[model samples]
Target: MSSNRDDIILNVDKLSKRFGGFAAVTGVDLKVRRGSIHALIGPNGAGKTTCFNLLTKFLQPTSGTIVFDGRDITRLPAAEIAQLGLVRSFQISAVFPRLTVLENVRVAIQRRQRGDSFDFWRSERSLHAYDLEAWERLSEVGLSDYAHVPAGELPYGRKRALEIATTLALDPQMLLLDEPMAGMAHEDVGRISALIRSLSAGRTILMVEHNLSVVAELSDRITVLARGQVLAEGSYDEVSKDPRVIDAYIGVGHG
Candidate 1:
């Protein structure tokens, strides 16, 4: 929403990814303003997931660069990228199924402090140092009531919220969410949507979501990609009306 160039926290220049003979993304440029909720939407197979991987360094790009918080991170490894505060949550609901909700967040906090090694060797009291913050994170995502419940026992939406709690434990400055609403039931969508909005107060979020109504309700800006290239970039009202975007969705049926 801020037009100030200096507020751009993530900048992608001519970003492309290729798989053998297929180019999944091509020369796509993006600018995400700090504290804005930016959505990347497209019909199925438009390379949204590939773009997320490239940005997060899960996959090396064939060309181009990614500048985050004014640092060149195009070639950084995924671990290094995460340490720099660019954390991502996958399309799948990732969590320690057997662990209690509080324990899950605590583990993430441990991961943040102790490199990739978990604190399984530490005593329970030693690990309790993270519980305060873990509880705070659980409270942030409205999961405080389920702190003692096993993650696997929570409903699907609660599992997703637990995933977000783990992500918050990383204390990310910018979060990239891959189809956060992917497996949500109807009631869970609004709950997760509200949680996402609340989380965006002082952070930047770049998400790939298929739920167009959610995008229209949450995004400050939207980028529509088709066939691996940027088809349109603007506000929801602007892109929703674009003939090209309409055609892309209709042609592919937006799987």
Candidate 2:
């Protein structure tokens, strides 16, 4: 909570998005500090995913600006933005089911390390190095035991962990996770939460999560959204106690 504006990692100013007449997000502003876990939470249809899409450049904003590490990146492509160290994991699992767990991560590492090269034989040493790094990342995420197994053969929860490990191999300075806990059992949730906490030790994270307990446990700040706008922004307790947020939840039958 100390003054760390100088450590600000992401700045979103008046970001808005619309689908024709439907406003998905309007005038949402946020500042994510370096190494902080910021959670965005709201009821269903709260525009959380739309906002995430806009920030990650999957969808262009109808208005406003997004600045990452002092660069105005609102107009950048998703791949371009990712190269700038901002990476996002989708709400749905994005993994190569047929590839081995280690191979999936190895591919991601190689892609990030060498860009898009068609010649696999051009850099055998580099490829091997990335494979080793991927194994290490898999170990970090507690998926080492499954490294040689086919990704599709792993349990749902382990597949999710593998996805996170693959993302980590990209060396993102800031990570955007959309409901990383979705579709998981309690044990899986706990495992993924621990992985998230460990991964965020020295990087910035902005996550859209419905699990309030996970948000409370991991977030340093919370942003509540409703009807395409930010209803409240504060620490978990402060946002939870806000009357507007309460009303928003009640209106959505989630209170």
Candidate 3:
């Protein structure tokens, strides 16, 4: 491990997941570089989502090991991983429907700053202290102007941006994104792509994105999964030219 110490941020060895008689993941291995945008992609049911869950510790792996920041976290819970600065951004459903955009980001900041001791009735003044930081996060994702707008009221793409803003509030060292470009117009896709590139300056991002175009544009490296295992790993151009990869896409419908 020390030989590759300077590069890899996350190391997965022989990872697997099983459900009753079915195996969702089987002997998958991934090495993510520090401060790089790495993508996990495949056709539907390629165990991409299951792998995401396992890495995020939302689901326990049946076998193998996961090491993050030089520590074995194979048995760690989701919350423990979050505390380690490896955080996951949920889909749009994670947003609070009633809370304003500013408020939602503030809540995330509060969680990071105060853990669970944050009191809703703590006093408007104390909460206001977080406003500055919250607004800054919103501004980072181009949502500052919509701070007053209800999170549920924003368009689909902006909601995704808000979700990212809230994730940034935690100041995570590594971000796990599940399909950041899901359900978006071409214009919003460009915006989120730009936002992701901007955020990648100092953060490690591991994402499962179906948009090959965005993946091609944003990823520093790509890991292609097939049938619960590593099928290919390389830059987009390199993987795109592999015949087996082309056959995988052709045999299974593109996700």
Candidate 4:
């Protein structure tokens, strides 16, 4: 499909990453459209995570260019990249254990507003300005009922929701999720899947997921990678039926 330049939120060209002499990702090009859900899927060791790190600036690419919105971000640092409205949610659940669910989101908002200055020592009234917005973010992720509960005490699924809430607090234009359903229970999967869908409204999402069912259900476009290269690109039905994709998955477990 042909996409107008303005319709693309992320443009990657000839992206590659080399750790010493071993190349993990090589000469991959991708374009993520605005306000759409895109999934990156492959068997184990397909370099999905390496590509993610390169995009988020956690690792500098050995070659290629990354453009977001309209600016060149290939050389930008991780913190600067996040400041530019590109945010990442890790595969692990990251939240403050002792802090209330509301507090965790508030901290994220504070970081966005204050640029890394955390003012927990300030008086209660001073931080009240952030509470309303934090509550809104919690409500967005279906966590307002647990506002007062400690983040650590939340169930695993709810904890992931809280992570999404914190991520929303940053107000990202494009969100990169690394394995959002990695360890979720069967019942919780539906809940988180719905939450992810809701979060996609008015924003672009690029996700690296292992669950083929989720990828098929949500992705507008899917990219398949194997042995550090692009294997296929199309809708789920198109790539799932590809002979190479079938061989790759059957030879080594999808993981």
Candidate 5:
């Protein structure tokens, strides 16, 4: 446990989730410090996504509590949680495929800024300002050149970048990424990795990733899950060296 109490940004106490007869997560406790990158890793069926769903209010936990930024938010709705500056990116791309790349991001900004719906007649000027801001965000993710193109027209890698740009437009204090590199090519992986690294400065990040190399490179701390429980929690070096972890990986064949 980190004694630096000042840095604690998110705390989970005795969190558990169940789906009728099945317990997907059990008695998991976690602490994520401000501005730190934390990785959650495990083999398939390890309950990593279940835990994330519970924390982000995509699913209700059967028991336990979640505190974010000093407030208890265990029962908050997903929208409310997002309003509190906790944002998540899905394993699959979640972008408006029919909307222009810039328009997709503009809607995200408008939501965060509490602007009116994307209406041409009611708030054209404000919407245009959001468009400019969206372009700026697109630039941040290196997607500015595609601003006017329909999002579905972009390559898969670029679509993912646009999703990140949309998330950025939300101005989150903490970001949760689930399998961000799942379907990308090696070059795309490197590009997204660099983008993640660059974005981590001054922000808290929690990611669930299957790639051990990426976890090792990006995480300040790592928590391992197995069979609906926490198996280990420590630095990458410590957890990787643990005999149990080695055995688990060997049994799962590098999942």
Candidate 6:
């Protein structure tokens, strides 16, 4: 909890979403402090994903308000929100498979430099201008050794790192990650956990993740949702001890 409200980077007040007559989310209030790693977790059908969609503008809310950096962005378009520095991930993972790791990151940097307008007439020399920054991003994710390898050939975990590098190229202030460690072995999990922690130094990260271990290890704050509403919010230890949160997971058959 931020003593100074001004330090809160993202706030949602009475946020809700409905599908037909079913309310996927109802009056869910959330606050993420600046430079904190916040985790949103819950059983299936708890509306965590719905909340994510609302934040990213993939789904419009039935009623509520969202404020990013003190600015009301409840109705702003997704692209406009991303342009304002709230870019999402996975959009980067879609990087061209045939492209080498360096080329893939360079493509992302290119997109950051030149919006969506693909000026085919530009010379190759102009594109190389972004290579230096691309290498820096790859280095940040520990991909410098495989710079010339095709992105498609990267190991499962490295592929995830490459995706992260591409996302970092956008230089977003706040990042929204949806299950960043969805499919990975144990070793990869540790590696990515470290990578995510390192990335949190100067930025706020709000993620909806199911891996409780990963969430417990990295999250500075945690919000537990159930039945389309927030059931608990606190530090990982505090939330883990909450009977309601424990029951929600147990009740859902979540191992």
lDDT of 1 by residue, 1-255 (tens): 356767999999999998999999999999999989999999999999999999998799999999999999999989898889899975223488898999989988888889877748889999999999999999999999999999989999988889988998888999998899998999999999999999999999999999999999999999999999999999999999999999999999887
Which regions of candidate 1 fall more than 4 Å away from where they truly are? 91-94
Candidate 4: residue 121 lDDT (0-100)? 92
Pairwise TM-score winner, candidates 2 and 6: 6
Local lDDT at 182 for model 1 = 95
Candidate 6 global lDDT: 0.90
Cα shift from native, residue 167, model 2 (Å): 0.7
CA lDDT scores, all candidates in order: 0.92, 0.86, 0.90, 0.91, 0.86, 0.90
* Candidate 3 whole-model C-alpha lDDT, 0 to 1: 0.90
Going through the candidates in the order shown, the clash numbers are 0, 0, 0, 0, 0, 0
Best by lDDT: 1
lDDT of 6 by residue, 37-82 (tens): 9999999889988999999899999999999999999999888898
**Which window of ten consecutive residues has the lowest lDDT sum in model 6?**
87-96
Q: Which ten residues in a row have the lowest lDDT in candidate 1?
A: 89-98
After superposition, the stretches of candidate 4 with alpha carbons farther than 4 Å from their true spots are 91-94
Q: Which digits, one per residue and each the tens of the lDDT, describe model 4 over residues 1-255?
A: 567899999999999999999999999999899999999999999989999999998899999999999999999999898889999985223389999999899888888899867877988888888999999999999999999999989999999999999889889999999998999999888998999899999999999999999999999999999988889999999999999999999997897
Screening candidate 3 with a backbone cut-off below 3 angstroms (N, C-alpha, C), the clashing residue pairs are none
Residue 50 lDDT, candidate 3, scale 0-100: 98
lDDT of 5 at 38: 97
Model 5 clashing residue pairs (backbone): none
lDDT of 5: 0.86
